[model samples]
Target: MEHRISKQMIRKIPYFEKMLSHECLESKENKVVLDFDEQAFKIILDWVERDYTIILIEMDYAFDLYELADYLGLDGISKECITYFHKFTIEHLPIIIPKMAKTTKFMTSGALDAFICRHFLDIASSFSKVNRNTKKTFWSKFPIETIEYICALDLMINSEYQVFDAIMDWVLSDSYLRKCHLERLWKLVRWCHLNDKDSSNLVNHLRISAGFEAKLCSPRKADCDCVFNRAKQNCFVMIETLDIKDLRVKVLDNNFKLLVSQVIKEDTSIASNFFHDEHVSDILFDSGRRVIRIDWKQNKYNWAPPLESYAGLQRRIARSVEYGGELYEELELGEDIANGFLLLESTETFDLICFEGKHLHRFSMPIHEIYKRFTTLNNCEATLLNNKIYLLSNKAILYEAHYFL
Candidate 1:
């Protein structure tokens, strides 16, 4: 059987080069015989010749091909296998990982294992008996390496009790057999973060394994999720500043560091004092249309589209704007409420939300009495959503204004 594979195909494969260099092939008469799996070699041969689409390759087929590539010292193909597997497993893991969890051959790839841990936590929580009705979980079926990898990602785990519950549900699935991994898996749980009730329950389950509460109390390094989560803060951007006599919006990061000063319009004096008054408040980010709506009193609204927005993502604040130009324009809602205002998209009436003194009620709406009760005052913050007014105060949400029959 002439395989017809060229020398170029094997050039990058070190194992075959070694065999030829050492004259390991059996020579009889005028021919040489090199023994190997014909089918595996055929697949590898085809792959070496650029014969197949990389994305369409099946996981199991790719796995077998990877093994053969590794054995044959096909470094190029082996590297491609790893990069593809990392992507394939993420997209296909919920269907494949359950079966792979019990197989040691598939568990050793560090990249595959780490991707599993990061994306599979929420899916794993569903198997915790309380979240669903299942006798067993894919989480419990995972190999020791996977269990440790999952446990190590504390930052990704939203609630410690969820992990504890998942581990408990795993052990309880079939304690006689599943408990075999408990001794190893229990050590990885972040016990200190659990509530006392959960801690007590776990302690009871493990008995002497949890030697002391103080033992697990040492804080581990926070993961990227934890660090990035704390980076969030409320940023108030000023629409105008006196120093430059130009319209500017200053952005501040969580640390109060000046990120950038966006020039909204060149000359602020060209516009009347209405646009520059310090009394101006409230801004609504219209992510759907990539526009920002700023309001002052109830007379009208100023609008500007973000400098960047995407087809499937929320828009961010625009870095610059030209007042009264195409990107920046004004919309008049014709109301007198200065507290705050929200525009109901594609609707005629604007829901004017007003707040004075200590008490606030969304039902104190003005559709019946015109804009008289809450006429033109500057105190509350407001936003429009689904054509309803989401009223807000400095510390908390006041209420969502709704019209009733």
Candidate 2:
């Protein structure tokens, strides 16, 4: 059936040629309906007439244009429409900011500081993960005033540790050094003390004027005493570089050994899962303390308990299961007896697969003897590989299973 356009439809003019080409209207013989605001409809009809009249409405209907453009699949029109709206939004920010600030004032200063700090730090941290040119563009748009404000806010709140770290990184960078000002340096030092408990090192590192050096250091016994004495006084314009090779060497050795122990523990726990299954037959090896069982029926598989049960088992075991380089979410077993796989029985199964930034997963399982096995299993690690899950026990033995959903 033919649809009649009302004479009052204002949008019918300029948008007519464009609307007719939409895929939604391609089958013209079929019944069609057009919905729009009464005022907008009238303006459209006015544009359609011989007179090329433009209507300026007080209401900035930018969002409406975007919604309509996207809904109609007007790719070219959508871009042009959004571009105009974006310009309008930017031009109107002065009017919007005060209104937003008033409504947002009830928000705690700490919370606002945290929100802004997180946003800026996220932008800074994302640099390495994106393309090099994109990283440059991101930094270019991020104003120095915004960075300074974030740094100042961090100093005021003294809660967000990552923001503090990001600010310190900027302070230490060559770019920051080139643009360094006395006020900025003072603010940085003040912020360092506010956020970090151990600011002696950072305070000592600041490049201050010789006259201000005394203010940064502790007063001599002969001088006037103040409770808030500076930690140290030597502030030279040139920063001293320390040889970090020895420190790096020590950290590497200790860290490597710790990592190795964690791996072995996780592997042992995963291996122990072999014993949990009653279907397994034959103990292949017994060292009095630990026994290795063989599951001949379900294909040859070996099992043994993990070496030790420690507090850091969850993280260590997860790394071990992912040693072959698979990604999986780590789930905390709420009760002593809970099954991990049973939790993914619902439609939202994808949420169970942990990705970076998602640290927690909650799921329920039926009470069973297997649940007891889970409680006994310490340092539990789990990962999804090739659509199957590999869970490691406290003793570092691995259990292979599949996603129920």
Candidate 3:
């Protein structure tokens, strides 16, 4: 069986153009036996025949189409394939990664490989509680270089021990074939991020293993205590009512599990207070522009410069929000309060503007109307805590806006 395609359509594909050129033997003979995925080739021919317009593509055939398009130097089809793959969720990773691992060329492109590396932590966390054998073999399909890249990433969200465990699991999946690469991958682990117990465990493992030596290396640049602690610490909310001495505090983890709840009676007077993830502080804003932070736990005081005074030290704490913008130009509106949202407060209304640069919040409801769903509004103060909006009132009432999540 043979299919006839116009010369104009054939010229659109680089492979066909070059093969059917005047200098080629196929052009002189006016016929050529081409070897390629027949289905993908037919799709390409249909696309070209229709004046190179975009066509609906089946996701199942995208991989094969992408490979043929790449071989034929069709940027349009390759881009379409990449766009389709970009929407893959965690469930699709196990299947997609193994297919991608079949060729090193896929890893070199940085399009799909970088996506996998960036979301590797999420993917691993998702499978942390699966069957032991499944967890151990989850990354066995990853190529050596891809694994090496992920191993060396500045991933401070989890402990280095998890990273080490992941690498070991991948290696032990097929020890006879993978054990030789273990030493090389082991060196990429940031040993400084390991806890005392994990460090000791690694030392014990090395004592038993052959051809391995410990090397001293600096911690990964992202292993700073601030970042490490941020990843480990849960969000905390400190509620202050009109009664200055009575304060309530609650700590919640990422999943909104309440870890701690306490009520403290103190002689201290309240001013402009800053609610942080770890502690509560009564900040003193003065003429000198100095901000004093009080550690509620130890009753210790520390003085730091006002963050707004220095350009580099400025934080996103917007007090007001303004709206006006056109296409391609977003009018800079309010400052950041929490998680990139601006709190819009007024006498009649209180609302949050979900700030996405260039993509402004198009709709807003009255703040008091929103408050009606949770609690009665009576001179309430709003602040971001634990990734939710806390509406505190003078009557010692606490209301949480879970819609933020």
Candidate 4:
């Protein structure tokens, strides 16, 4: 049967091209019966006719309206329906994201679903600590894309353990759909942060791992500070550096202006020659412990390799505490770093320094970790004060210096 609509209206969607079919052309009624919801079609018809007000009036029925638009080849209306859903998600998505994810209705690869998921994913980090309800959504028909995105965030998770828990929940929820995503998601977890205690816990979960390649992945060294970092309530990242060569330890404010210039009579003799051909790695000043271990990375002899080689030499090593630059004890290190940068009973952990004001490493992780691509920054001078590492990176062309969080 022929449709009463004009050629212009039918041309908008290819689905209506069926009007030119042999049976349709031969029919005398000049009419067609569509196998779609009449209620949804009426709303779409209004939009097609530029009755845009019907969208707001029938906004609550957006899922159905969008379905009808998609089925009937009404992309214009479908797009508008996506815009309408923005407010819905921003206003209501947090509480319902997981619940809705499980449904085949709007959450199953449709324009509306994509739009909502994208918006939610963008602000996922801003989610106030994951609660019981939000956690439920993790195991629901959560979008695999959202799962991957969350895994990649630098600040989204409070605990890698919780993330592992979520994965376990997700895999158990409906293994058929999510099993394929296991290994792909597993690599994103920062395993090295967990100590032997926590790393051992992951052993059971690794059994079902579907996608990890043995040779392609390696965990970080035992010294990674991820576990300790998770314990911090708030990080005070504002501080200045101390000129190691000078007798006085200089303290700078956030703007890098010299705030306090005071002399520390720690036997300059030992610290003086120490800075000549050496790079200060870390300065541990626990006055409470009455000892300062000035760490430096240098060309130390390692006879383990072929007669003239240093292959297995421990590159990152620290010395014992000293009194007034004079030694109190000999060099000490088995696996030197403990609890990462927050040293033993560390009241003040200072490791940052500026050599001639041109080079520095701020918040530097281990060099071995850097080589393994486990850390983005290789090595830089750092000092810890109150469990906070004051890292320095010189910008000679810019201002003298500045403290930034």
Candidate 5:
């Protein structure tokens, strides 16, 4: 009994209607028939039924079928087909490459050359892993022109250190390929060091190239500690203008006093005394403005300002801090601070009072709002989060809660 596919079922198969068209199915009498086994025919039928799914074809079939399908121009396939075929082309290289090279006259222009080079590189890489048998096989089949092409392609496309090592091995084995590979390698090295400064490995590879001795040196010896140190130093210098010590000192001198004073106002006297040293600038105060004299050191009672005095000085400071005690009742009712000035939790909202220096001012919005407005208007980010609001600008000023009332 013969297995029969109904016309209706065949019609339901994707691409079957197109295949059944006279232009596709009709065979010319004079045309030579390409032999395909029963399994190959089944694969073709599956390819047709699947509506030429690129991923499926790539995963399921051999490279030759994939190439044929790609050449046939099934919609939504190109790069993936090339990439998939690339793997199989590498795997069955020994059989495929020599055939193509012998029949180069019949092959498409540059196709044989590309196949030869790609397989030569693959075989060379394989030889590096196995014994002399593999090495002899690779050497016997490898063409001089193909070796040079592999070296060129390796330099052009291979970014990984391991791949580079394999290519370099092939390069150093032959004098002609070595010189050509070196020329390409030099260009790649210079491009990596000068243009792509982020490629630390490439820079390291360049250093390896300088000291590499093909006969005696192990490939792993390419990782020279001294070269890495030099590359790291060069990388550091390229990106960082200031020394680490200078950066630390500047950052500490800029934000340290402000952070300390904001967190601990009771310890303000210590910071104040520290700031009096000629080298230390009063960062808390506006630059070029005379420091206000507060007799906190002399009077024990004056260590903390009265709430009434704080209220009086609210307008002098740019921002005010709210003690947990003052907002405890409001917070308990569920209100969140917003825009630096407004506090909204559940149903209640209120504007905050911000103070700059001795002046107290009622802000229509929160400190965050004022900061956003200032940043938007000036096109800059200018909020320092500490115990107090530290206004970072041409003239830095620390706004304390006591000053804001």
Candidate 6:
């Protein structure tokens, strides 16, 4: 059996044109036999004929088409493949990354590579959520270079422990030979990010292994603002107004476990919300656009000088989030930016807005309507910790919580 296409139409592609133009076997015989996906070849023909109405591509086949298009020097389809991949969810990454890593074209492009690194946390977390067998299978098939790139990323939101667990899982899957990679991979884990107990345990366990050595040093000082380096250090601070003059401050870890709960006397009217000072690592409460120090360790809250009083202060935290982009969708604009998402706050709704140029991806949070009857985002003190948004009401109740990507 043979598929016949117009020679003129086929030659529109550079790969086919070059082959047929020169004194090649295809040109001499006036026929070309090629091994490729039939659907992809048909799509290429449709592209050549400008038959836009009949051309349709699916996610699974897009990769095959992309590889074939790239091989055939089809820049239009190659760029389309890149655009398709940009819309990929975290789950799609584990499937595509291994393939991308092996392709030289993908390596040279570096666009998709950066996407994987940027969303490394979601990808790693997706791995963790899967069963052990599935996770092992994933890591076993993953390219070492891609894994190393993910491990070495300074932009990850997942704790270093998760990164350590992922690498160890990969090593333990094929311990005999892969163990050699353990030392290099172990060095990539940001030891400073691990808690005291976990760090000590890891050090002790590795020290017992013969010929294992590493420098347990400071936290990774990344240039970009990741969730870890941001003002909120993976913990949400909830400000609760108790009576007229006191505010109860509670610090909750990523799991919403209470780490610190203390009541301090302050003018609750003015000190309604808080912001982070990344430089000093302080959770300073905002009072009339001024800074106030609440030394929770000492169980005291004191008013500090006005923000202007601190002359030459660089990187001042903005009192309000500015919504400057064009409204691409009909959803209400958000009042604050958390985890790189704009949030719309109102008594009836809480929404997460992903404002990409000329487009908006709005995620309406699943807050019970009954809760919305009495609760409002404006009335709650909102904070982001470990990629989850926490809305704590003035009454000290956990109003609503949602995870943002």
Candidate achieving the largest lDDT = 6
Inter-residue clash pairs, candidate 1: 336-376, 337-376, 338-376, 338-377, 339-377
Predicted candidate 4, C-alpha RMSD: 22.5
**4 or 6, greater by lDDT:** 6
TM-score for each prediction? 0.37, 0.29, 0.38, 0.31, 0.23, 0.41
The runs of at least 3 residues in candidate 6 whose Cα sits more than 4 Å from the true structure, single-residue gaps closed, are 1-64, 67-83, 91-114, 127-141, 157-162, 172-180, 190-199, 207-381, 384-390, 394-405
Query: C-alpha displacement of 203 in model 4, angstroms?
Result: 2.3
Q: Using alpha carbons, what is the TM-score of model 3?
A: 0.38
RMSD of each: 17.0, 22.7, 18.6, 22.5, 27.0, 17.0
Error of 5 at 324 (Å): 65
Residue range 179-253, candidate 6, lDDT tens digits = 888888887776776779988888876777525765676655553222343212457788787887687888898
For residues 1-405, write the lDDT of model 5, one tens digit per residue. 112344444443334444554455322231223343334345555655665452354333344444444434443443554444433323333334444443222233244443333233234433212232333324324454454444443221223343345445545667454545554544322232222343455556545764533221222366422121111211110111243211111222222332111111222443322112222222211211212322223311112222222222221111232221121111111122222221211101123333233333343213333433321112111232322322332234332232121
Name model 3 segments beyond 4 Å from true. Answer: 1-114, 125-137, 195-197, 209-211, 219-405
Ranking by lDDT: 6, 3, 1, 4, 2, 5
Ranking by TM-score: 6, 3, 1, 4, 2, 5
Whole-model lDDT values for every prediction: 0.44, 0.34, 0.50, 0.39, 0.32, 0.52
Q: Report the lDDT tens digits of candidate 1 across residue range 110-221.
A: 4344333333443353222322234344455655555555565533444565566666666666677766677666666666566678767777767754343323442455
Q: State the lDDT of candidate 2 residue by residue for 1-405, as single tens digits.
A: 223554344334334445555655533653446675444444434434634454333224433444444554545444654444323212232222233343221223343443333234333433321232332222223345545654553332223334435554554454544344433534433432232454443445443421233144233444423333122211212111134211111111322432111001112222332113333322211111233333323333333432221111212112111111123345453323233321122211111222122233322112222223222212355544445666555666655555432
Each model's backbone clash number: 5, 30, 1, 15, 30, 0
Candidate closest to the true structure, highest TM-score: 6
The TM-score obtained by model 6 is 0.41
As for model 1, its CA RMSD to the true structure in angstroms is 17.0
lDDT of 6: 0.52
lDDT of 2 at 233: 19
Backbone clashes in candidate 4 total 15
- Count clashing pairs, candidate 6: 0
Instruction: Select the stronger candidate by lDDT from 3 and 6.
Output: 6
Cα lDDT of model 4 by residue, 9-104, tens digit? 654555666555445652345555776656776655655566334454244467667777777776777887766553332223333344344443
- The local lDDT score (0 to 100) that residue 45 gets in candidate 1 is 70
